[model samples]
Target: MSPQEKAGSGPAKAEICRAFSETADAYIIYGNMTDPDLYYASRFLASDSFTYILLASGHEILLVSEMEKNRALKESCVRDVRTTGEYDLRKKAAACRDASFGYAGVIEELLQKENVRKAAFPYNAPAFLYEGIRTGKAGIGVTLAKSPFLKARSIKSEEESACIEESMRGTEAAMEAAIDMIRKAGVRDGFLISPGTDRPLTGAEVLTEIDRVLTEHNDLGDETIVSCAEDSADPHGKTYGPLRAGQPIVIDIFPMNKRSRYFSDMTRTVLKGKASPELTKLYEAVRKAQEAGIAAARPGVTCADVHNRVCDVLEEAGYDTIRSGATVGFIHTTGHGVGLEIHEQPGVYDNDHVLVPGNVITIEPGLYYPGLGGIRIEDTVIITENGCRNYNKAEKVFEV
Candidate 1:
């Protein structure tokens, strides 16, 4: 069954309407494809481009192409799905020289039919689209409003949490497979050797294995990081080159489920052989800092408080942060919310946002030393009334 079939007047729609009521007469979205806001508003996933309008009267409408009208009617969250052809878009386009204006004319006609005088749009709407709507004959006024959909999406429902957990399960399985490969590899001349080949293993080879495992679970890894040695010092560095033993290797994997569209993020630093004394010290510090951040992630706690606690742990270890300079020590935010998008709201930084139940977030702490490398540990969790529940079960071992 489609998502819309299982959904029954969810709170997302009510929250969106409440936000819209405070801003404009109607909330309008126009796109040739699915925007994150539109996907959240309507639980219906559209493969093709379409327009969605939600009125203050609680009526929802979808204006789609004739090719998708039937599917929209059967699968969309909105009951009133109509074809743009019904609005004479093709006829209007034939008479008008400007295609953009012609499309806006059809939209304006629909708004007038609904008696909508002023409409609110997402803040990222294109300037051309805004100008087209404002210049239309309907005399409609447009305002670029911050997406109310994001506020509704910040808190997960039981069903949403379950979907995220399922995604995390697959992520952990893939992560375990990657770690297993590193554990069983033979060491030759301070480099990790491939199991089947005598040649040294490369970061691309490990990432290929990771993607293979994720594909088996119907997920895809985009820009997955598997950096080793010097490359690990740069947090967002892409994976490359041969793997070396007795050095830090950061494997940060974030994969998205093809079916649910939810994502899971997990990071673990491992060494194939014995870790150097300095590397060991860095790992321990990061692990303890991560624990402190997790401990602070409870309902009613502020995001700034959690970040500060993690910083305290790292600073106490005599490490520097971005506040000192860009080259070393603790950098980046503590963590961020994960869902349909890998990074979302309630960012665990020096922000004043309060943690609430149903808020799913990540607690990642890392320290980087120039020339020595970097060590990071991360886990996704859901905030509960008392504390947070970790979703990742992968063991945190510095040396494999």
Candidate 2:
């Protein structure tokens, strides 16, 4: 058995330490932990220092700045926390090969005192420090290793699921509001203002209105998509333009509710004018494909299977299924695990990852055509013992 298994709290830490130790005797996780996006301490405290203390069998030390000391102490479970200036000013500064050469020197000294020889860290390790270590001043063998952090992140804990569920409710409300605005805007009177205001509720207006509604509700992030007409051909296009009467509008709003940093992503297509037969057929295909993808999500199925089944449905309808890379019938992956980070592990693509009961992913299947338009139907889902539960409450019916 591994050293971690002998001193186990659970698999999350165990997996992390095991991956690190395989590559090195020590790990230096460098990050601007202060960045809210990097370590959303308020939402989920999944920090490297915390993992090291709980998982590493040998001594683990953290080299932090003076400013982050108190926050790290309150948030991290790591005990061996020391500041960058704690070591000798000149010696530590020399040891710091790059910007934080002082910290690097201190880390090397700490490892030496602890008799650690092998060390690992991410690619962003300081250039000078890495070179110095290679030259033998650090007295440790170093290698970079990809930590299995996201795999552990894929499964949601009870508290995390609750937070995500709450975020989902906010997203559902915003979607309904956008639908309402679309209805009202369709009936509003306006004249073609020419190059200036040819369209009253142009594509840009609809997109902005949706954001306006979500902002009123609170805790919604700024990232939103409001694409219309040919612009919708790009799966993630949100350019400045107007909404034409005959074109389809794709409104995809996914924001983190301010109350909780958790996120919810959902997409819907609305046609402002009469829906063409071709447009209706494409929309129907996307809807049925999303349903099929969700239906295939269960505790025992693999992510690739769910993706393949969805592709089958779209291919049957004679839409472009295979992507040569950028141009694709389904340009993006079927879905991704969601939690503290919107896109995490258990990728819904042709891969080996298995679906577990606690897994939550999005089921978004879409078809895009250049100069024509695009249609995508997405729903966030959770895998249950026998099936899945969709979190989206927005109606799937067309507005036209």
lDDT of 1 by residue, 1-400 (tens): 3444323365666777888777688888876433666766555666666788889877888888888877777767778888878888878777777666677778889988999988888877766667878988779998988877776677877777877888888788888988888888889999999887898888888899999989998888899999899889988875578899898899999998877778889999999988888999999999999999998999998999999899899989989865455457998999999887899987998889999998989999899877999999999999987898999988999999
In model 2, state the lDDT of residue 260: 50
Which regions of candidate 1 deviate over 4 angstroms?
Answer: 1-11, 32-34, 323-327
Q: Could you tell me which residue pairs clash in candidate 1?
A: 32-49
| Candidate 2 lDDT for residue 176 | 79
Report, for every candidate in turn, its global Cα lDDT versus the true structure: 0.84, 0.67
Winning candidate number (TM-score)? 1
Please identify model 2 stretches exceeding 4 Å from their true place: 1-9, 33-55, 58-62, 88-91, 94-99, 124-129, 132-136, 187-199, 212-222, 257-260, 323-328
The TM-score values for the models, in the order shown, are: 0.95, 0.83
lDDT of residue 161 for candidate 2: 68
**Candidate 2, 1-400: lDDT as tens digits:** 2211222235665666676776676655555432232332112143332212211464545455566667656654454666666666456566444445554566666667666777775565556556555555756887765644556667766666666788877677777776665665543342112133334655566556667766776747566887777888889877566456556778887877665556778898887657789888899999999989998999888998998888889888888774335475667788888766677777898887889987989999988898688988889988877898887877887655
The weakest ten consecutive residues by lDDT in model 2 span 46-55
Candidate 1 root-mean-square deviation in Å:
2.0
